[model samples]
Target chain A: MTEASDTLVEEVQARFDDLTILEYEFDNVEIELARKANALNAPLYKRRAEVIAKIPHFWALVFGRAPPEVETYIQPSDEKAFALYLDTFEVIHFEIDDPKGSPRSFSLKFGFKENEYFKDKVLEKKFWFRKTSDWEGLVSEPVKIHWKKGQDMTFGLTDAAYALAQAKKRLPPGNTDKSKERALPEYKALADKIEESEESSASFFALFGFVSSWRYVSAEESGKIRQTEAENLAKVKRGELVEEPDSDEDNENDEDDDHDYQETEVFPGGDEVAILIAEDMWPSAIKYYKRNHDDDDSDDDDMDDVSVNDRANENDDDSDEELDIRALVNKGRKEPTSNSPPMPPPARKKQRKA
Target chain B: MTEASDTLVEEVQARFDDLTILEYEFDNVEIELARKANALNAPLYKRRAEVIAKIPHFWALVFGRAPPEVETYIQPSDEKAFALYLDTFEVIHFEIDDPKGSPRSFSLKFGFKENEYFKDKVLEKKFWFRKTSDWEGLVSEPVKIHWKKGQDMTFGLTDAAYALAQAKKRLPPGNTDKSKERALPEYKALADKIEESEESSASFFALFGFVSSWRYVSAEESGKIRQTEAENLAKVKRGELVEEPDSDEDNENDEDDDHDYQETEVFPGGDEVAILIAEDMWPSAIKYYKRNHDDDDSDDDDMDDVSVNDRANENDDDSDEELDIRALVNKGRKEPTSNSPPMPPPARKKQRKA
Candidate 1:
């Protein structure tokens, strides 16, 4: 064996010993452990065992599965990390982590070098989250990882770590407040305009599409907002709540405040709030233009052209970095907020059927 | 109003009356109904009510919402069906069904024209299944329909009909005997070959991927098969059950019979069985080839070339049609046979990490 291969074996061996001790300690404390103990151990044991098993599997595949003269090197970086170099073109990194104080909780990261095997053959990165109740010793359903273009090589690894951390409520340092406040009057006015508009059902839906594509609001959330606004309007008609209709001066003041806030507040990852504000104002702008041209039916064509041009300019200003913000917003929406099963990722705009 | 619009109103009015009768009949039979009455009525009432509400919403969005000069027409085809033609290229079809005997059970189909409004805007076709017990009148989680390329526009409608029919045990006529017999010896041989192979952890996983992609076997089912095979092998080792190892002649006879069976049996919808058989034999074929070439290191390159060529040939023979069969197989595996929450769809192959 090469020196690198020797180091890999030694490193894996050391981690294997640590895992064994952890398992033993877990067994001893089984009775005293909390309910989470089982949850933690379920993934931990499976991951550690998988990592240990992968060492021999990697070697066998590299040597026995491939050509014999295809030179390879394997090395251990630390007790918890190892690397496999497949000639000069490819490398595989394997890392196993069990945060010091967490029992029965572990994560495994397997990194593949971007090579022919990955480019043409490998489709997705998969991580198994073995359920604690799987007594049959079968690996449970896996969590699949899809690599987006321009994603970092360690994207899957970091995501796994983040998922585990979130599960354990130990997520990395970040601002806890992610929620943004909406100006109720502005939302109410938009809802009213939509209700009164002579635009076709198709146009109404098109407006929704523009909003969803430009803002953080999901299709589901947008529906909820519409329903809420509708219900609130009904209540107002029934005199169930006092209405404080804002004057034109108040509305202008609110818009200026919103614009200033959008300019000043930099959302850490993306400007979702700014986009939301922009989309929230979009319908009003159209309504204003329509009211001015209400007497001239022929002018509708000019209105459409203007709006299309404006949208094109907006697209031009929104860089790829900003587009990625939409992905982040989608990810944030997927995080489970309650005991309920996570709502399937917000339906993509491309999948909508009117 | 035009004659078409009058007919549309008349048809909807008739269905609305039938729905009202159904609701009243349901109320009369409430005390005699089983506990499942509530559960059944939950989605039923909400869907019925939404359909009713949508009538006004639809009319308002069509005539009231659109420009007066847009030139629209609406007509009813039957008591339970209607259509709205918005100009030349756009049409919307609405259908409501309450199979005569199934009280408090209904389905609504909303069809959209494949116009500009739909082209770049519509994503998922959504139907809300609201529970009657929900006092807040919040729309429950929506059931989304994704249209596959070349799929019928009314696929969602037909699928919903099928689901309701299945629930009511009123499915359309067809031969019901769908189960196939398993050839245990072949499975045992395959399992034995995998266990004896030196391909390590990777081989074991390849075995799983092969099983998952090929058979109706789930991860859980694969685990059970492995456990059973391991135990049987142990018993054989201990000289318990007579091995009755197949002689060369017996193996040849079995192969001939298997080939004849494959030629005769036809699977409805698609030949999933044939594909399964092909994929099931894939790994074993590779293993056999590898075993034969094991002693000669220089032959490795040749083996790789042969395997790659074989795989390419297989790919050429397997059309997109058969690839879709794999998806269907995975879907079948996800549907729980017993009383359990439906397992999420099988993780797609593109999402696999390793």
Candidate 2:
């Protein structure tokens, strides 16, 4: 390239870089917008939770009418667990205002009455807004659900994941390298078991065991790393430290492929499912509850499709539809809809219409 | 249903209705959020436009690298017009603070140097946020371009649309009914010509002739209708006027089908195209301009795909890539990229990779 052309190229690049800084400013404004929205929404959500608590089977029916993204992950066995014990569902945007964290970080909490299914009164799973060298988004660690004998709705996926987590916890602190984690006996056992298991239908209960394909980093740890990186960048600019271009190569070696995750093991599409529940299902719980009534008042076609796996859609207006009997003794429905042997609700009904 | 069950249903419905009010409140908060963000962004965008104005062929390269939603509309002929004299483009959200209007309403202004395509130095199209009885969205009227002899890029579509608009303007006041409008000679002529024409590709220039699938009502007219509706509803509640169940039926009769819009005449996906330009193209023009440079700096694969219809992708860094020769006589690029005959830039290149 000629000197004049090179000079022109540099001028263009300078303007482009300036615009990138502006884009960063735009992103900061977006983050502030999210914080404001979250603050305004918190009180509204609290009031909604209070109102929904009075309606029996509110969470159960809400799950039934959830948008397909969430519905697709639910299996028949999970529906049975939900019908028996599910009381209320709540989503918390726990890091909306944290400068070091992200607005996308949230926790999904499920309240359940003591039932034959599990011992826990509340199960909470948290997804953290995290960043790796090349990627940035939500990442979650597996949650352990202590299931009763023969009541493990996820088969053995959750158990395996939990056991692996315990074993990893015992590893030397800095040995949390993914290749070393994969080399653990517990991790191998889980991987082999996942391979041996048939390609069976997934249960929503399996979602509790989801681990993001991206390496999981706690928000606190990520914040520390970011602080150090910024400090080092400043130092390098001041000639106090040499810039290390090879650092990226080190991160690349610990790539996600080290996990060797199977589709079922990692819970495919889990992030989308979590987001849909947090943003749509939780906020629109009343609409979903009303849908249960709409389905009853509208047609027998909607009512007839409730089977074991589809227990979420059962004309639960009767026994199953009632809020957990022990939890809401006086809130049961007076009359369940007409009798219909339940089958699975029609899959992708809207897509079929299109 | 038993009376007890009926009472239960009513209770449920009451709670559901309360939740709907909350949903409406949520929507209001969203509107306020948009207002706040737009205020913050206004100055940032103004500064950006100033920086970009100094760059040569900024608008042309930005349009070339625009997302597929906008790119799909541009044809070879339209690209030639853009290459020749498309000087600068601006998007203004003209109704951001209008109490009765919407933030979605905007005007796209194109400042062009003297060119063969048209006589106007500046062409502007405004899309208004409108509401009909059944629909609410952005709608626009066709713009007339005084084409220089033999330079009409839309192949008569714009002429037909503009002529129809003129004819409609002459209709008796309060006789703007669609059925009557379609009865006009110009309307039928366009419809018949549309029917007889073979399936032909479209030009982006033709988008200036877009009409919404929903009936077009001016923002002022819509505001008046809303005010009158509110007054009527209040009068009915006070028993000053009897409620009319047939009002909706009257609206249904004036439904969109009365216009009998063919897919091409109304311009399929015009609303989407308008929104993409306003929200994406205008804001991200710098990223797009950088992409043109990236294509040149990278490899032969990206630079070799500029054809007549694809003139936007031509390595114009030499001649066409420079700012319109007359507008910025001294602002020409020093070196154009390596030469190869340009084909239409690869269609949906990203999708092809997938």
Instruction: Provide the clashing-pair count of each candidate structure.
Output: 13, 12
lDDT of 2 by residue, A1-354 (tens): 366554564455445444645665677787888888887777888877776776656687678677887887777656656765788888888888677778889999999999877888999888887754334567787898899999877778888887887888788874646767777888887776666655787788777887775455656556755664455444533434223334434344334543545432547567778888987877666556656544442344334222211224423444433323332332233654432222122221111100
**Residue B21's lDDT in candidate 1:** 30
- What's the residue-level lDDT of A182 in candidate 2? 76
In candidate 2 chain B, what residue range of length 10 has the lowest lDDT sum? B345-354
Name the lDDT value of residue A248 in candidate 2.
35
Model 2, B1-354: lDDT tens per residue? Answer: 366654564455445444545665666776788798788888888878787776656687678677887887777566656755788899988888987777778999999999767898988888987764334677788898888888776668778888887888898865646777778899877666556543777678777887775555665556755565455445533434323335434344343444445433646567778889988888766656655544442334333322112224333443433333232332232554332112122211111100
Number of the predicted model whose lDDT against the real structure is largest: 2
TM-score of every model? Answer: 0.19, 0.71
Candidate 1 lDDT over A1-354, as tens digits, reads 346534543343233223223333333343233233333333433433343242222221222212111111111111011122221111111112321122222222234344321232222221111211001011111223343554323323323322332332332333222222233333333334434432322110011111111122222333333344345445534434323223332122222222322211111112222222222221122222122122221222222212111222222222332233233223324552321111111100111000
Q: A-chain TM-score per prediction?
A: 0.16, 0.77
> What CAPRI-style quality would you assign to candidate 1?
incorrect
Consecutive 10-residue window with the lowest summed lDDT within model 1 chain A: A345-354
